[model samples]
Target chain A: MSDASQGASALTPEVKGIIGATAEKIEASFPWGIEREGLRIFTQAIMDPDPRYWDDEFAAKTKFGGIITPPIYCTYIGRRTRPGADDPITRAFEENPYSDGIQGVRTPETRGGLPNIPTPLVRTLNAGNEIEVRQYPKLGDRIFSQAKYADIKERVGKDGSRMLIVTTETVYTNQNDEVLCILRASSIRR
Target chain B: MTTAQELRDKKQTWWDDVDVGHEFPPLVIGPLTSTHLFRWSAAIENWHRIHYDQSFAVYHEGLPSVLGQGSWKQSILPRYLKDLCLPDGWPWKVSFQHRAMIVPGDTLTIWAKVTKKYQEEGLGFLDLDVGMRHYAETCPGRATIVLPIRNGKPIPYPFVPPKKLSEQTS
Candidate 1:
């Protein structure tokens, strides 16, 4: 944590100005297009044998008419992999484990995830999410996403430690620009 | 008690047959290992160390062990709910909070009990009380799903939330 002695102003005037600003060209698109296996693996990993994700015959008869990606699938599609050799995951373990890990590719031209929020503090914990789904991405559909810092608030922890609650809203859309889902995620940075 | 095999073979649930107090089969996801967390974090491209580095998670964060990713944990809710209301239903709006931490080697049961079932604008809907737990309830949340009525037309694709449900509290 860097200089929390500033109290709430630790938000830094510069960080407060960028609220509602959308990161430009920070495209979170899936070039792979939704596929059957991706759907199966996701559900299976979670131990949900929802036939709609696996059983072709069962899914064929569903309202979806066939396999459909799980609603939360879009949440995972908002990230981009690094270019060429040394993927983010591999690099995460190979380098100093104590480091901040791989640089976020979300803002390729900028530093850090969902740039413009330079809180004086580090260490963020996933608080939770409020998601309203307009639709689920279908198989063969390529998902496109853009994100923005919706809000930021400061709070004092039970221990009297100051924390910043950062909320980001990422909107997912299909190739047709039809909205697929909107995820509002909040994290506590202390 | 619900078993994995039964869940695999169980047919989709319909709004008509579901009772207000009905509890679908519980979906048990893990005695999750570090690999499980790694796979999940990898799939989502979330490189948060608390999820993968035991030392970082323990010594640094003061956690008992490497913790599970809340995003990964919450994401599984839809799969459990969908399995209970599939073929002719949709897992619509869902909200949940992490509330607590989950460590490796812990198995979590995701459960949903129908709290209410209603019809409006010629479509059927069910409000569910949902949650996840190991030794205790770690994530308590709710989901409102659209289910088909008997043989009624499939819940509209790209599901549109009925106006009546707009202001309904969870």
Candidate 2:
């Protein structure tokens, strides 16, 4: 915990400015691609319950034509893996000071999650989630992801404090750029 | 009472007969494995190693196996609730807190009780305290669902006039 506190205070003005500038530069690179192995690793991490993921025979029986991936798997695909490097999740965890696991304290780069944007001084919360499934990914399919800073707005909640809500929209496509899923997530900052 | 009369008197609605002390119907789900995680990951495009790489998860996070994503649990809640409630029964609001870790192979018994029921805005809403317990340990997540009263019509939103009343009248 103390380590996280130290990391939080280390964000100097220069670092903040650098990250802000970088965020703009990165935004232009809208969509990115993910490796097949990386995608495999992440699904395993979340521990999905459905057997169609595990049993080949059962998966073949389903309409998906083979094993299908879970809905939330898009969150990890095609993210920049390192800082000033391109990987989205890695950059957030490795770079970006002030990423102490608290909302609004960490930038998107510091959030260490895929399909996350680099934003400063905001806390990310699961406002809500909606999933629409067109088709599920088959085994060994390389996924491509396109991410953009979708929206940022300010509003006053019932208690009357100004809050900044930032949304990052990412669309996942297959190697052929076929649309797979669209993820729209919002994070709150004080 | 005669057996035939008793049979006729039985309540069909879960709300009418379910008691506060009653336990929810048990649902057994999964012996989760790496393949399951892999498919889920590929489907969601998740690349996190903690999910699939058991060595990394155990050494780094001190977990026995990959931890289930909180979102997956959220998705399952609807299914569990639906099994207990009727087809048209929809939960208005659900709030859950992650209390314990749920891994593959852990058989969880999801339980809920009807704590209260009331009418608000002309809709009958049932408040339920729901939980999931595995191996006698409960997780932090709990949910509250609002069920519409049977045979009651849902309220329609009031219409908003395009122009002010004064303008229309004038």
Candidate 3:
């Protein structure tokens, strides 16, 4: 990371300081378990007509013993606040009406309790993700996540512009601490 | 009362059914609306304003219009890929880069084309180059899908991966 990345506006020492920092485990629950309604709308949103997602009788006949989630749910809807916890939604709007709400000045959205890395870049975008689809989290499972700043680097784009690319990895687990999936997510800030 | 192989094949996307250049049927969604974006935002619990606040997105953020969450755009890709593999097989690994922004009213057509194929742990694997577009390829990347081979056993429930394939394997 030293030699090859030296050509551009390299990352500042403060930015580089976060490379291997891992966050404490964040425990959030699906108190009512994973909701069937959530499953329906998500599949509807994607236009997935698979009977496994929609058919009750058919799902009952499968090895999963009942309706199972569409594995990708591990990333999208798996985590939620613990019961009796503060509402992040209500908090965001109350905090800043005009804020983008994702990375606002008061608070930036952290993934699975990963700590924030302060950067000079104002705007952020979800660059993409490297995901390993592992075990499926069942309905009524409490989802816990532990995250880390896998890497933070500077890159010179085609127009000689520089931006900081941040990558984070989060592991999702059930209440029993059974591993469900590992997601390597990256975002570009400029 | 089902064999593991039978349970697996119930939703199996056949390894024998594909080749290096095979293309999965595309999933077309949208002429997206703010309503669509808002519901998704609420569902995922990502309360970002760009997804719902038009005035803020246009004037303050300098965006073309109220934007769709990249994660929402991302949700479409793997859902299609997983169904393509179905029942027994898994959309084992996929990576995507959200290059272009998705605005309201943009129709997204998600696609994947097989790039490589191999065998490991007695299961079949196929690599694919994928894209999400509204005429231009906005988000692009690759994925590796695990599938059941002809007359092979089930691919397992917890979806165990083989010994580290390679950094570039996906």
Q: Pick the candidate with the highest DockQ.
A: 1
The fraction of correct interface contacts reproduced by each prediction comes to: 0.60, 0.05, 0.64
lDDT for A160 (candidate 2): 45
What DockQ, on C-alphas, does every prediction get?
0.48, 0.07, 0.46
Model 2 docking tier (incorrect/acceptable/medium/high): incorrect
Q: Candidate 1: lDDT of B144?
A: 82
Q: Which of the two, 2 or 3, has more lDDT?
A: 3
In candidate 1 chain A, where is summed lDDT lowest over 10 consecutive residues?
A: A103-112
Q: Identify the leading candidate in terms of TM-score.
A: 3
Clashing pairs in 1: none
Off by over 4 Å in 1: A1-27, A36-40, A54-58, A80-97, A100-125, A149-166, A188-190, B1-10, B47-49, B53-62, B151-153, B163-170
Ranked by TM-score from best down, the candidates are 3, 1, 2
Off by over 4 Å in 2: A1-190, B1-22, B136-138, B148-151, B154-170
RMSD of 3: 5.3
Arrange candidates by DockQ, descending. 1, 3, 2
lDDT of 3 by residue, B22-44 (tens): 98877778788998888887777
Candidate 3 chain A least-lDDT 10 residues: A1-10
